[model samples]
Target: MLELLLIACLASPVGMVIEEPPKHEAAKVEHPKPEKKRPSVAVPEEPPTAKEKAAPVPKSTPKPKPAPPAIDTKRLAEAEARAKRLTSENAKLQEALARKELPTGGEIRNPAEALAELREGNRRFVEGHRIRSLLASQDPDLRQTLTKGQAPFAVIVTCSDSRLMDNYIFDQELGRLFTIREAGNCPDTQGVASVEYAVEHLGSKVVVVLGHTACGAIKAVAEANGKPLPGNLWSFQAAMSGLLETTHEDPNETAAEHLRHLERNNAVRQAQVVLDRSEIVRHLVSIGKVKVLPAVYDLATGQVLFLELPKPAKAGESAHH
Candidate 1:
């Protein structure tokens, strides 16, 4: 007990307390800093850099080119040659044909050839078929080519019947032939001039006297009953007067037979008249330059029947009807 009393007395004298000392007398301590709040850890963001956002660019396309021009020359060379051949042959064929002694049809070989072409074309037309090749042909250009000159293959002298379209009937392409259409197949100054041009300059090889069935001029002559044709129709009437006279029938003859006879004779008689008048045609014949043929055309069947192409007057024989 005495030892405990002695220690307590010494410690109390030093003034140390069990309770904490006052704020002023306590030793100071520095405060610890708070830990910073971090971002959510599953996906973190990097700061944006400059190079990742370069400006965008556009794409380019290419252009197209042009087209070329057209041409048509396949048949033209043959066509040119045929034209020349016909012109040459025509002058020879004419001298070998005449009125009564008519040359053999076969003598003018190309007459049959041309007729074959016409027949084939007409058949195609009737059947509603056309050569597609003809569509490809730029024949309007051919006209421009022909203005420099034309040498058509043959000549057609036909009745001026409105229904007769020789071009269509013959299926002749442009510049392939020379054509004359007249009432009663009459040849006037203008008509003769046309013939002269075809034979002399154009080198037309053959002249065909193409007469059609059921002609209006022939009908007019038949209706007259031996009476003179009307005054205004003199030129037309005179041309067929011989046809009316030669086929004149007794009043008792039926009208049908009268008209038929008139039609046929008109063709034959006109063929004779053509031979009589055109010396260019004659020279073309007598010299074997061209051939003249009498052809009767049928409206119903579109057929052409050649009745005669008399042989040339033998070189020494005086020839007449």
Candidate 2:
């Protein structure tokens, strides 16, 4: 019976074991029941196990940015080729012009050297150390040489003032300077055409637009003050169209001083007019084959003050706007 009772107790879900109480306790005490062992079953692990999840992963780096575009090589090559072609064409054109003109002997070819020659000649004139003009002995030789073909190094556009003689002022001999005289030194279309002929055909290296201190035409135009002059003289006012407007009379200056200022401005304006009117002269100047300068001749001192040239047009620009 005791054996059967033990078997029944083991079979019970609550497997408890009873124990006698200690002498200090009055009631009986029951021990805790033991848990039954569960059957073992396989459990599928998730993609990342605890070990895999705990491990650190490397971070992904970003990509770098691209560089900027370069200039087109094809366009650069075309531009260089075009420049070389133009230069060759210009050289050929100059050769043709020189052959057509039949330049005389002892004429200056370089533009800078020609300008220096003029300056030196003027220095001699001012100092009264005249050499070329005093060589009366060379007159026959000079006349004969000029008969071959004239190649004046400098073209002088001056007033018809009786007192002023370009050959004497610059101390240049015959065939050295090509002079074009007008009442006011203001060039008309014909005057500009003459300049073109001189530069293009005669191979003149420098163009001098010379004005004097006491100019009758300038004085007349200034006195006219927009009022038209009588007869053909009115052409003078038209030729120097904007002289008075361009130059203002200073309150501190006398009438003579103001007239002198107008003369200077007129000289510069006429020089620019030549460039404006003649594309041939402009081209020669742009190529550095020729130079156009404005000069003021002092009647009192017989000195010529060459003014600065006007600002040049930009490349591909025909004239200043």
Candidate 3:
């Protein structure tokens, strides 16, 4: 029993020590992902050969480009409206200026307006043009126009003395005044007719009988027509005796005084002749249609002693008229 026990113990130990074989593993597939690589080569930037360069494109007539869209109707309408408004506004402004009653250097349309303008200008000249700057330019257009026609604004009937020049006395422009120069500024029949034309046709408003100092014409009348005044003036001496006789009687008066008295008297006489001789001028004067001013222009003072008259007032009121 002991021997059997020993054998059984050995056998049981041997059986307990026995182990199952390990499972076999799959075969290693060490393909290394086939190394998954292609041959690495550098590429050239150029074509493979110069002869293989791209061929030039053939020249062609290009298709017409698409047109831009038509302009908007609203934009066109707005532009037209703006243009019309501007044009209407311009016309309105022109109309307003036309109707305005201002002396815009236009023609003096009436006798009364002409007189008023002369008086107004004289007033401004006597005072000063301190009001505002004048906008009038010396028109070059006048230069071209005056070359074509004679438009004398005034007619000066004055003495034929060296001391009296019409442009100097009145500060007038060339062709601005028509002058009929004579001794004593007296009206013969010729002078009478000339004055009528100046007033009636040339639109001359005034017949300026401008007289001056140291008159030879009056001296011939004063010295009793004895010394023989120069140049076809003796006939006038007979006509002017009444005026000259007044000067001679004043013995107290100086030679200068004699001349001044003569100057004034001659202007007065001529003014009378204008009314007596020219019926048209006389009618024009009487109706307040035109003015006839008898003026004695002083050589020393450059001032005019004027008589505004319906002229030919008698010698009795010579100082007043």
Candidate 4:
């Protein structure tokens, strides 16, 4: 019975030891995840047109320049011509007034005629009708004429006062009047030599010792009253002191009258002094070759008053005998 049971157990797999199946842990399966898709953008299919590609550019315009101002050429030319014509007419008028006959040689050749001419010029000046031509010693033609030789008709020894302009006072131009001036119209040796030159060399016939009112030199001498004057002024005072002493003062005369008397006396004395000191002038006067006159200029009236007029000699007396 046991053997039969073992055979049955072995055949029935119950009696043998059962073995456990192998336990292998299942391996985890790996798989790739699906990729995320981006959304698609739509693209335009058209190209750019020719008008859009070729754009026009704007042009700038330039500003115009301003016009120049007009000139009155015609009017300007007419004015210039008128001025020229007026100048010509004025020059002609001057020539007509100065026209005079000139005589041949000698000291003054004709003293009376020269005196008359001077008187006429003075009259013109007094009347305020001075001829322009007589004043134009600067004219080229007149200057040319004078350059030939100077023949002044008068020798004026007058005070060196600015108010006493020899040319304007006499209305005489260049080459017409020879003048000598000192502070008091007093002549020294040098002055005498100049006068001699004018008479002996220049043939001047008339010598006028001219004085004026309010002579400063005369006043100074009077005020000094024989006291010594300062510097070179002493010479002038000394020369004038003798005249002051010789001048007779009137008791009833006003101060102005006294001053006027002194002025007149001073002029007369100066004229005598010229005669006394200059042998040449004395000889000329004695021979009737020249004349010396004493005159006073009035500052207020622009008039010259003759204190004494020298008598004109006979026609033949003018020539040196």
Q: Which candidate would rank higher by TM-score, 2 or 3? A: 2
Q: Per-residue lDDT for 1 in model 3?
A: 22
Clashing pairs in 3: none
lDDT of 3 by residue, 1-321 (tens): 222222222222112211221122112212223222333335455344433434454677865655644666664564345334333433442343456522122244445554454444334333432111111121343344345545455567888888776655554334456688888788678888888887777666667777776677776677653556667766767557467545444788887776777777668767776776678987887676567767776666555567654433463344322
lDDT of 1 by residue, 230-306 (tens): 77666666666556656657688777766766766676666666667777777777676766776777787776766
lDDT against the true structure, each candidate: 0.57, 0.72, 0.55, 0.65
Q: List residue ranges in candidate 3 displaced over 4 A.
A: 1-106, 109-143, 147-151, 225-231, 246-248, 308-321
Return whichever of 2 and 4 wins on TM-score. Answer: 2
What RMSD does model 2 have? 41.0
For every candidate, C-alpha RMSD to the true structure in Å? 42.3, 41.0, 44.1, 50.2
Ranking by lDDT: 2, 4, 1, 3
Instruction: Tell me the spans in candidate 2 whose CA falls farther than 4 Å from its real position.
Output: 1-107, 313-321
Q: Estimate, for each residue in 59-170, the C-alpha lDDT of model 4 and write its tens digit.
A: 5564454454354666445444433443444344344335532221222365676666566666656665444224332355556545556778888899999989876777
Q: Find the candidate with the highest TM-score and give its number.
A: 2
For every model shown, what is its TM-score relative to the native structure?
0.57, 0.65, 0.53, 0.62
